[model samples]
Target: MQKLLASCIFFMLLAFGSCTQESDTPILVSTEDLLFVGGDKVRISGRLLTNQDVLATDHGFLFSTESSFAGAQTLSLGQKNGPGRFIGESTGFKIGQTYFAKAFAEINGQRIEGDVVELKTLTPSVSSFTPTYASAGNEMVIQGKNFPQGTKVFFGTQEAQVLQNLFESKLTIRIPVAAGQVVVPVKLVIQDKEIVLPQPFEYQAGKYTKVSEFPAQARIYDNTFFTNSSGFHVGLGRLRLSDSYRSFQRFDPTNGTWTEINFPGNPRRFAFASSSYLGGGALEVDRDVFQFDRSFYKINGSSFERLPDLPFNTREAMAVDWNGKLFLFGGRDGAGSVVREYDAIGRTWSQKRPAPFDMSGTTAVFKYGERIYVLAASGQVWEYLPSQDSWLTRGTYPGNTGQGFPFAQVIGKKAYLGLYRRTQEIWELDLETGVWKSKNQIIGLPQSINAGHFQSNGMIYILRSAEESTNGVLPMELYKFEPDAI
Candidate 1:
């Protein structure tokens, strides 16, 4: 009996040892992916069981340049739950974008990946809005809300003169003063359809209320945002990769306009191999190098040049700047990974705390004083301490919105993000507290495939596919999200 038991134990140990490997090949989890929406943080949960000490990629977004909040995409491992269940959250999603996720698990140096999951990005806001003080019809300058530039606002039965627009959401105009209560119902006309605001205002007072006294049709949430999608003060907002193609634009909420910038030669600038060039001022400036090269690079306006690269090749990794050194995970594509380092000034790569899993496309956002948040593709979320390059998996992407926001671009102390494949929408993740609170969604372009490259300079642009289906052909016209006031 003792001999038989020993044989069984030996077999079990061998089996578990063989399963602990890493893999870069994608998993095929269905595309019913999770979707994160609203200004509230959501959750995603799952399960995993393995007798091996395996590490692998789970979920995250890639195509860095396309994401308005593009940072590092992520990879994740399942957490222990209910003997089998695991959970996660897509904490830093950008609005108006779509995304897909996957998972991998390994035991004893043998790795296996999960399937892919896909989901659509949601509109920045559910409705368009306008604020006016004019009574029924005369003519009122209806300050637009939740509006993309070029959006038309109406004053009841009469079309108000759109004198000027500030930010895609703010507008100024004179009500026709047709002669009534000086108050009126405002509506937004889009696609030839009329949407009356739920809240009404009175122009009688001869003043406009931007946030308060909004009509029923006004978009309720109004988180401030700037061009960077990270508005602690500059209106930094949740940055969403508006298009799959390369393009840059900014929406000025102060003046409704969609400003455009020349496309960058480095379209996928957010790749793990490219993290070194985030600039010396960035929060994750790696002091130590990884697998790429010892030199790093930077995004100078709209170009890329030779800089330091990590000594090792990495994928779906997380990063942070500590004592001027970039502490990072040398995640494996699938062959079990390591945690490498890079020196910015010295221009060299070194070693540090290795990651718990082989990861890629993970997001690094911070709550400033509290901690730096790390999210992964496999729905793994954790906080990293620069003092110790270690990780503690918090949870999974909130909800099954496979289309969760994956970028976390900071503006001052605030962090903003954009969801994949979404037309116009952003989410704000406060870095001071590690909690998520969303604001108003932007109304930019319509959701389409490969929409990571869409950028806005106060003016949002949407290009219809000229090669989609038979009757789906549309012109690649530049539709100004919201033109600026002149």
Candidate 2:
């Protein structure tokens, strides 16, 4: 009986030794069948090769631009079943970019990585196509990646004539004349692969036409304008001789006439204005600085009342009203990207997040929908989210940034922008798509600098003064612009 017990104990020891040997074996992982699923996307398949009593606690594919796996992005297949095949997917790969990927598994507490596999994503893609609305004979540029020498482009079923295949990423093509106002797909075909832009391009129907001119005395540059319930107000500008004026005026679109109004504050330059949250045709003005006075004021009827002073001296900053609060962004405070917010009702000032970049001479700051936008002198466009108190770089402005102050006014879903530096060209930007279209040049108005732009009752008004001044005053003129008529 003792001998039999010894033999049984020996058999149990053998079974235990076998189990420890199997669990101590190292795990093997490998990646296979990396396939291109289309633009900027790929499918990765991987498998574990070792069998163990404890399944893999973690398994997935690791990928990155570099092979070191430092700062690499991981696709986690959490608690995956071991010794079997698993699949994972990744996206947002740049066109024509090479990536390194490896399969990994964690068993018991050890992480085991597989051999690195190299992958190259397909290059054919379209980043952006300009002139969303165009006419036949209009030149359009398709910007993207991986355009082979013989790649073909199409607008709907009509093929566009390629004017210049400049590079692998840029193609200049003349739009084919199509039926007016027809929405059509823009297609790019390379080899056997084809890509269609998500947003269809529209063929424009109307052309730019001249409208009535501004009926008031033209004000010099740095003039302030804001829209109110009654009409639009224009006032407070620097003369050509560097002297400031307090003459204020308002335009009534209903009668197409301008009336002089009392401006109670001392003449100020670079004063920013916005429609007053309080009613009765009142407007708010801030950053008013000239010779002796630098304060905030509210224009109520013929009287101007002082408000709380700005936290700091700010000039040339962009101001916009959001939900009854005033937000000032990037001006001449020596702070590269300063952003300040004011609660008019509470008479309090608070600093928000700065802009993404310096906005010293921003062309325009206006609100559309829930977001506020800033167009800087360097042609960079940024969007500010009040809820997030953060800024996002919205594509660059695709217009001529000449030596003039940037002026922009939003009317509906479109914003009209132009530089006053001897440029007759006006650009229309679709706020929804961030696409810019060059409209017809302003006619019946002389080229001027530091012009003020304001929109009221669906009509855009451009206030300009003579470039050359007589005595200290510049000949001022205001022109009414009807975009649809153009």
Candidate 3:
């Protein structure tokens, strides 16, 4: 009897060890992300350990997992003709609904599971939220939440603002600017509800602050703070945390940090820019562009307004406000060239000038003694003096630069530039002597191929690259730099 019991225990331990070995292999064919917001797709791809075998789901996305879940997803499967390539689709997937999924195959009668993925379907939305009657221009901020990004918002007759529009349980809109108390039944054509403030606000003057010695193109606002690509306010001292997307996160200098209120926009898009102006001896700030859906909205520190279009689409270009005029320059586009100038005062794009020779991997900021100083991809620098109205060649970038540039912006008197391809080093510019300096040797940057990358101010941002670069790194969350000693 004792011998028989010991044998049974031995077999059980062996079986468990085999199971652990199978789970250790990470060979998987999967979508880009496990859980997806509505209207997003997950790219299912991976390898199957060279020889083994390949199996995919044919019906709904159904897979068993100990951890991780993708709501309900419709999934299909296919084989790899290449090394680790896979093909498949999740069937009957709603846009914003969430679900979990996994891939597995039976080998020698034992089932093996792959990576766990999750997905979410988009929620239904009320398309229109309009106000009628009374005054205040029938203004309404049709508060729409949990809806897919492309879902539209409408006010009475006009289409509601999109792209760079605020998201959350609340979104404000100006109907037509009316006079008295207006009552318009809130209606939504594509969303869940029309958002009307329970108590309408009376038009009143706003109080702002005056900030100086900051970079013009680097983002300076008096009574205002900047928003991240996420379209939320990085309320200076309010939110002790700062976003790498914005040049300088305006904070309450008196308190140090404040709770950041996320502005309702995609932080990854380049459509957002800020400027500061003096009004009645006070400094005022506003964001004039939101690039995601091509919407141009202006907002003071307290509220927002829909503004007009930029002279042209620009990424990596910096905006400067001077004597009531705006200047923009030094960023890449699909065609690959930095913008020279956009006379917002004249509403025109001046003839393209000699932008930074290396258009990509560049940054620009307004310096005290010069126009706007430009940093280039190859560690090159240029100065734009508005008074001279010409581009001056400056010193070379002092740090590592990449040709696959993503973003670069300035803060305070300093300028920061990020290299594309997710390299850890960031190049900076010294406003005092017009010299380039490299700050922070990012040690923990994610290893990815083709992925999102950006840089700004004192912070350095690197991310998990979804695609392959020289290294096989997967895309993940954004990484902030913690300098070693420099």
Determine the backbone clash count of candidate 1.
178
Expressed as tens digits, the lDDT of each residue in 1-486 for candidate 2 is 322443355456556656787655545666756754444566887777654645788899898989787889888889976476788887666656778888888877998776688888766878888988766789999898767566788888888888887646789999997743367888887666679987898775324332334443444556667767666677776555556656767777677667777776666666767675211111124343223234787655534687755556666666778887887777664755888788877888899987768875556777889999887777777888998998888877676777647778888999887764667667788998877776656654445654566777776777665565434433565677766542
Q: Report how far off residue 214 is in candidate 2 (Å).
A: 5.6
- TM-score ranking from best to worst? 2, 3, 1
Q: lDDT for each of the candidates?
A: 0.39, 0.69, 0.41
Model 3 alpha-carbon miss at residue 201, Å:
60
Clash number for candidate 3: 94
Per-model C-alpha RMSD: 34.4, 20.4, 28.4
lDDT tens digits, residues 1-486, model 3? 322443355456546556776544333223223332333333343233322333432212353222444332335452223224344444344444455665544343444445555445455444444342223334455544544344454433445444344543344555443222222233344344344333333321111122211212122111122334332232221111123242223333333233334443323333334443111111112354333233344455534454554445554444555555655554444424544444545545574555536453234344444466655556556777677667777777655555444345555665555554456555555566665554534443434321222334444343333332223322233344432121
Instruction: Point out the higher-scoring one by TM-score: 1 or 2.
Output: 2
TM-score of every model?
0.34, 0.54, 0.35
Candidate 2 stretches greater than 4 Å from native: 1-218, 277-292, 301-303, 444-446, 468-474
Better candidate by lDDT, 2 or 3: 2
Q: Best candidate per TM-score, number?
A: 2
Predicted model with the maximum lDDT:
2
